[model samples]
Target: MSFYHNRLLEQDYYPVVRFYYYKEWEGFNMPNHSHEAIEIMYCLSGSCLIEVDGTTHKLKKGQFIFIDGDVPHRLFVEPGKSCRMSNIEFHFEELETVFPSFRHLVSEHEALRMLTESPKSYLLFHDSSDVFQCLNALILELDRKEDESVFTEQLLLGQLFIRMAELAAKQQNDTSEQHVYIQKSIEYMHQNYDRDIRVKDVADAVHLHPGYLHRIFKKAMGTSVNGYLINHRITKAKELLKRTNITITEIPHYIGMNSQQYFSTIFRQQTGSTPKQYRRESRYTDSRTVRSEHFKQQAK
Candidate 1:
């Protein structure tokens, strides 16, 4: 007789849900505070305001906000108005596991990556999918505290993340004319950042007059096209410095800045670090991370 043997790996990575609750609030105001876990607050009925990083956003029924970790925010419901909300705060913990971390998932999904890495501290979107259902199911599963509930909770959480990503993608794909123009302009800027492009050029690319484009772009993006382009270039420079061995002098020209001095000034103004200093710090941090991981594996 012939026999085959197979090995099963133990699952060691799972999400740590700090708190999950569904509550009704009447005329309540929460002080601004921050936490280490990311939070999702969904409005089920009525409306409320969430002030994030000094910007106030209204979350109406069927709407939700994804607040990043360590972002200062507060909730408010006007005096005579009652709001019903479902909230969950959670973070991922990694041990020796076959499953991936949240960062790995973020890197794999473009919409998820954009939502998590956005410059804004919080993202608001209208839920049109099973997001609320999945969230409610997750809360229910977690409350069971049964052995099987662990696996069910993880599955529901994954579904919730996928649903949220779908909503975020839909929000970005807004079909309004102004939103289309702004998206097209932003895409054009990203595609042509290596070239010496201007606001007029972007306007022409989108078939809008410069003046009209300026008004709509600023209205939608909260920044002028020129300002956005500069910020984009700086962001690209930081990526190169952190991830690549490209020389500092070549980075400016590669990012469409003709003068290294000008690039340095802008970089310092934005990041408070020169190119060399930034690169050194990034490399040091990377090396330390590698060493830390190596030691962790050795311990395992």
Candidate 2:
């Protein structure tokens, strides 16, 4: 299952994942080199045009492009064109923790259906300076020679993946006859989560009946609209608890919970701990609560 070419690799420089910058002159044709890992290339400076399976797209500064595993593609830098790109090549396994959809091989011909893009697609228009700074920092962390724990860096990379997915969904003009209605309903629920929202209100936004909206939301969000709303409210409550010393009574009002009792019930069910227990357990007073007298090796 290894995707590496043994002829081009030796023990010294074999990398399952790597991050580096590349720049080259015009008229460069990378005549179909193949590899095992998915290639994510971020154009850092200048521009180029790429061809993937007879489809062409313009690649410019700040756009990140994806080349699925083993899919043949080529890059071209036209006359007077200069390209400097920060590229990360990593195995699909590294992506599993973030995207559960990638747990199985959907086959080379069907990989686009899994990620919901063309075989070789560019998630263009994410040309933000702050975003690139974060990506650059992650690249530096990935390529460090000194061995260190990469858990945090991988987490950041996962977040970037989520953001990229969002951007792509916005740009994709899914003209499918069936999916068009589903997409419209999803957008409505996302935008109106804060106020006293109703299923009818959401359904009207997408021209669907309320009952149909319930079934579709469950399928698409992987949860019902009501379920997602409750989770979103709970998420906001937890963030408030962590950042501020807000009382439990104040939380329900701030986060739009209907009642304190309902909030406590949901919190206990979801978090397995009541609000008071959570706040108490989260705070540390340096062994004030740990009453163990037999401690000879304690802090001197």
Candidate 3:
């Protein structure tokens, strides 16, 4: 069974980017699945083809493809070639918060506007492009697996997004100066949600009062700060329940909730099922889908 995990920068709701570099020796077949993040896959070597919404795109060495979030896609390599690629996944909604100018660029520029407004399955880039360099560096940093500074990582991420956004804005484009106070609060909320964090704590992180932060977060994200926090925690809990073998009782602790009773109440309210029920239904659905696909492939 294959599942796609959405990785992000620890503690930030905005632009949680995950980087991966994979070398598939006998080639690989990633079954069709959809995710909530835009994915950029770059071929460092070898070759493969990606099928999205029934269209097949040939990706060769020195080329890459940017797939929009929530698009179902699958990848496969031809019989002889091995494949090495860098995969970057991130939420597109974070683009506006992370790069304040991104929305403007999308509105003003025709190519970028089209891409954003009506995203295709993917956009292709060549090795010589500036975006490629930024992606390559980010991948290398992620692969190192060390105690790298978050500031440095954020800078690189900012640079990469800026270049890609700006490049799309015209040719192809800060971290600190652009972030609004509410964005900072959102980041804090994301980072500390698994703790016993409160609105005051989030406000203090950005030097604002609790009430003021509440208003701003509500206006910006259309939910109260606490509401956002609970929603985020519930989302994380759902992911864990669906993807992991952890017991339902342990899930509350994992998500920083105080008790299983509260977790079950909230889970049932939000998802219309208890955690165990949800997990069982989800696993059953996945297995059925997998079996159906297997039969189809065999018939073909």
> Each prediction's TM-score against the native?
0.54, 0.43, 0.43
Per-residue lDDT over 1-300 for candidate 2, one digit per residue giving the tens place of the 0 to 100 score: 132222212222212455355555466767756565667777877887777656777788777677765666678888766887777776633332332222222222232233443333333445445556666777777656465554556555645554555555455543243266766765665665555676678778778787877875686568876787678777777777766788889888877675899999999988999988776765653244453443643744
The lDDT per prediction is 0.82, 0.61, 0.70
Off by over 4 Å in 3: 1-13, 92-118, 144-149, 166-300
Which candidate tops lDDT?
1
Sliding window of 10 residues with minimal summed lDDT for model 3: 1-10
Which number leads on TM-score?
1
lDDT (10s digit) by residue, model 3, range 86-125: 7888653333243333344434555544444433466666
Pitting candidate 1 against candidate 3, the one with the higher TM-score is 1
Residue-level lDDT tens digits of model 1 in 174-291: 6377888999999999999988888999999999999998987887788999999999999999999999989999999889898889999999999999999999999999999999
The all-Cα superposition gives candidate 2 an RMSD in Å to the true structure of: 22.3
lDDT of 2 at 127: 47
Q: Is candidate 1 or candidate 2 better by TM-score?
A: 1
**Higher-lDDT candidate among 2 and 3?**
3
